[model samples]
Every structure is written in structure tokens, then in C-alpha cells.
Target: MKKKTKKSFIEYGVIIAIFSGFYFTGLHTEVLGFLQRGILATGLMDPDFDKDSGHAVNTDYPEADFSMKLIDSKGENVAMEELKGKVIFINVWATWCPPCVAEMPGINKLFQDIDKDKTAFIMLSVDQDFQKAIDFNKRKGYDFEIYKSNGGIPSMFSSQSLPTTYVINSQGELVLTHMGMGDYNTNEFKEYLKELY
Candidate 1:
């Protein structure tokens, strides 16, 4: 019985030490995000958009709030109106949020698959320290056009979540608002965006 207890204690200590190492090195976020990415593979994290429902790009919501100010990677100020596309995919995220990190790969894939002329992908970083978001983007090589918030974010995109996705159609209508991590690189999603364009 004592031998078994000693073995259990040693196992627990090793586990704790490993976690402590991850935390101190600022790798805990990535580790946790990796675990959540596994969940994303199960197709459970895919956004809820029914193409057959005819409301895939919801036409019911109010106009999109394009009042938020942003700074580009080159430290240049960008106007919201400058982002011209048939459809706009705006995602609000932070580097430290595990779920945000988990959903980014799928988003990056979606960005690559879509037609740049028809769709604009805006990865808006809300990290308190903008440098962290910039560094994280560089390390991940997601190649997304990431921006940091320069001023107050509009209320329409506001949510009680770390990652919120707002889709806007050509008419500037806020079509869909998904408030969580999502697998957006599906053929159905591609077709849905194409149709809007």
C-alpha cells in the first residue's frame, strides 16, 4: 500500500512540474489552445449556418458598426471604409485566449480558400499589449492581415466572449454574429460566402 502511494505522489509531482514549466514559459496558452483545437476537429466547433435555411447570411440584423478604429501591421491608421469587399469577415480576438488561438488555424485556412476580391478577412486583435498579438501572428505564420484596436470598439460586435465573429454582406448589413470559436474552412462555408458576393 505504501509503495502504491509513493508512486501516485511521484506521478502527481511530475504532472505539476510539467504544468508549471508550461505556465512560466508562457506556453500554457498554446498547450490549452492545442487541446481545444482537438475539439475543433470533431466538427462540433463549426459555426451554425444552414445554407438551406435561406438565411445563411442573416438579413435581419441592423447595419454593421464600422466605427472602430484600427492600426495596421505597418503602424498605419486604416479607415473602416477602406476595407472594401463584397463580404466582410471580422473576428475580434486576443493572443492569450486559448479558444481564440484554437479557432485561428481554421480561420486562416478559410482566408486562403476564399477569393480576396470578394471577401475581406479582418482579424482584429483586442490584446491589451498589441505587441503580443503581433508577435503571436508572426510566430504562427497564419499570414492573416491582423490589426490592433486603436479606439473604442463598436457595440454591435460586442459580446461576453473572447472570440466573436461578425459577418457583413455587401449592403453593410450585419448578417451573422457568432460568439465563439468556429471551424470555418468547410466547403459549405466557402459556398455560403461566395453566394453573398
Candidate 2:
């Protein structure tokens, strides 16, 4: 009985240590996000039918101007003001972020559905490796414009979290600001963009 108790304590200690490591290293959040995505994909969890679906983008901010200095994929400096007179969709995301990766397909679908001539899509990656951002875009076959912040990002758009997105109207006012992964391919989201134009 004493030997069995000792072995059980050791096993518990090992399990505790492993979980603590994962929690401290931020792997726990990633793991949970992965599981959530898997469950949603399996149809066991209804993503679209949820009455209080957290997957929808939250848009309740007052209209405000957006300005940013960014480097385009071609290494040319671009200003947000230059993108005025067009509906702008700005996404600050990183390739390593699981939520960012998961929402990318929806964003791409939105990009394809919109009129390119009247709207601009800027997907700025915050990856440490600039080349990795470029490579990821290429590998994913996303034709939407990719960029990196060249100057300080506005506080309104800044977040410690990855996958923040902003929608600005042609009149240079922010229409919506969203944080975290959301389904952007829905008609509701498309209607919001249409209203911006």
C-alpha cells in the first residue's frame, strides 16, 4: 500500500509539473485554441447557430480616423492617408498565432468577395522575420496586400493580442475594430463593409 501511494504521488507530481510548464509558456492557450478549432470543425459544436456566438466580430467603437506608417511588401513606405478615399481593411496578425492562422481563410474569402478597385486590404504581419511573413503569404496563396509597420501603430489599433483588425470607411473614419479570430466571410460582415462604402 505504501509503495502504491508513493508511485501515485510521483505520477501526480509529474503531471502537475508538465501542466505548469505548459501554462507558464503560453502553450496552454494555444492548445485550447487548437482544440476549440477542432471541435468547431467536427460539427459537434455548431459555430454558426450559436445564439451568443463569440466567433462573430464585435463592432461598437465610435468612428475615428486611422493613420499608420507601414512598409509594403515591395519595401516601399506607405501611409494610411494614401489609402484614403477607399474602404480599408487592416489586419494586424502573425503567422505563428493560431487564431490569426485560423481566421485568415475567412479574411481571404472577404477579400475575394469585395470590389478591389473601391476597397483596399492591408494585412500587416508582426512576425520577427519579415521574410517569413512574405513566405507565409505566398505559401497560403493570399493575393491581398501584405505589409509591416514602419512606425508606431496607433493606440486604437494596438493590442497585446494577435489578429486585431480594423475597418475604415472611405471618408477616413474607423467603422469597426475587432480583436481575435472571427468569421469575416459572412453576409453580415459583407454588409458592414458595403455600408462603409
lDDT by candidate, in order shown: 0.83, 0.74
Candidate 2 lDDT, 124-190, residue by residue in tens: 8998888878977888798787999887887877888777877777666665667766677777667
TM-score of each: 0.92, 0.70
Give the residue spans of candidate 1 off by over 4 A.
50-59
- Mind giving the per-residue lDDT tens digits that candidate 1 earns over 1-197? 99999999999999999999999999999999999999989998788764532235454557677777789777989877766546889999998899999999989999988889878888999888888898899999997789987777788877889799988776677767788898888888888787666
Indicate the TM-score of model 2. 0.70
Q: For candidate 1, what is the total of clashing residue pairs? A: 0
User: Which TM-score value belongs to model 1?
Assistant: 0.92
Q: Count the backbone clashes (under 3 Å) in each candidate.
A: 0, 0
Best TM-score among the predictions, by candidate number: 1
For model 1, which pairs clash? none
